[model samples]
Target: MKNWLLHILVNAIAIIIVSFVFSSVEIEGFIGALIAALILSILNAIVRPILVILTLPITVLTLGLFLLVVNAITLAMTDALLGSTFEIAGFGMTIIAALVISLLNLVLNSFIKD
Candidate 1:
């Protein structure tokens, strides 16, 4: 339970960091970041797996590079669901933001233990 909350906070921080990197990825504030992060986490867990399986052939063909597209899809889904709170400008921006957020999350999560 504690770990879960910490994970969410880490994701929120990652979102905030990513927002700073790209002007197109606009997070209203910390609360917006938290909301976006939570939605992103939910989508990543529920939607990302299905996408990974569906795109497994291409994923293998690309040597896992396609997972970045999967991540971007999930990020776009989160933006759609959040309405105005979190806004990613376009598909190109989504892909870039997803990449940065994924990298940030990877680095942040490494510090936390299960």
Candidate 2:
């Protein structure tokens, strides 16, 4: 449970950083980032797997690169859920934001022990 909370904090930080890096990605504030992070984590857990399974063929065909699109989809979903608080300019920007967030999470998560 503590680890999960830590992950959420990490994700929130990532989201905040991404917002700063990309003008197209907008996060209202720390609280908004936290909420977006929680929504993203939930969507990744609940919706991502289903999407992965459903898109296995394409995922395999693209040598797993299609997973990035799946990631973007979740980001878009999060943006939709949060409305104005978390806004992504467009699908293209969302894909780039997703990649940035994934890389940020990878780096951030590495500092913590699971």
User: All models: lDDT?
Assistant: 0.92, 0.97
Clashing pairs in 1: none
Q: Which candidate leads the pack in lDDT?
A: 2
**How high a TM-score does candidate 1 get?**
0.95
| Per-residue lDDT value at 51 in model 1 | 99
Q: Each model's TM-score? A: 0.95, 0.98
Clashes of each: 0, 0
In candidate 1, how many Å is residue 80 off? 0.3
Q: How much is the lDDT of residue 67 in candidate 2?
A: 99
Q: Model 1 residue 9 lDDT?
A: 98
